[model samples]
Target: MYGAETWRTTTTTIKKVQIFINSCLRKILNIHWPDTISNSLLWERTNQLPAEEGIRKRRWKWIGYTFRKSSNCIARQALTWNPEGKR
Candidate 1:
């Protein structure tokens, strides 16, 4: 799915990884993971916050275990690697 000059597949892959990561994070964080099968915006927004912040803030103990896997990737893509880009 890697088409020329398009990050659609990359973005989609990142999103899916994000969803699965969020699910596992919720379970590990002692939060009740939900299984509702509706498309209500209210439920959607409600379910998004904790996981969003948790990821953003790196709020997990097991995160330390994954730091090794993420560190190199993050460093490679980080703004410092592209000085012209905003930090």
Candidate 2:
């Protein structure tokens, strides 16, 4: 999930990332083979947000940080810029 906040995520993409996260967490918790746990419980134990929610939060965090920058900043301008013509 490195640089995931910058990704243009789709449902498939988010699902894949979520699956990976869950598997990793399960391994870290030693919840292997015959053992099982619900995703909600896993998240609770790990104190983790769902992949989509986490990514959205990171994206918005970046946006807010950029917005607080000086007006001349390129990232802030990219977010706030309006085109005068249709693409």
Worst 10 residues of 2 by lDDT: 1-10
lDDT assessment of candidate 2: 0.92
Kindly report which residue pairs in candidate 1 clash with one another: none
State the lDDT of candidate 2 residue by residue for 25-72, as single tens digits: 999999997999999999999999999999999999888888899999
Predictions in order: lDDT: 0.45, 0.92
Would you estimate the TM-scores of all the predictions?
Answer: 0.29, 0.89
TM-score for candidate 1: 0.29
Runs in model 2 deviating more than 4 A are none
**lDDT, residue 67, model 1:** 48
Off by over 4 Å in 1: 1-9, 33-87
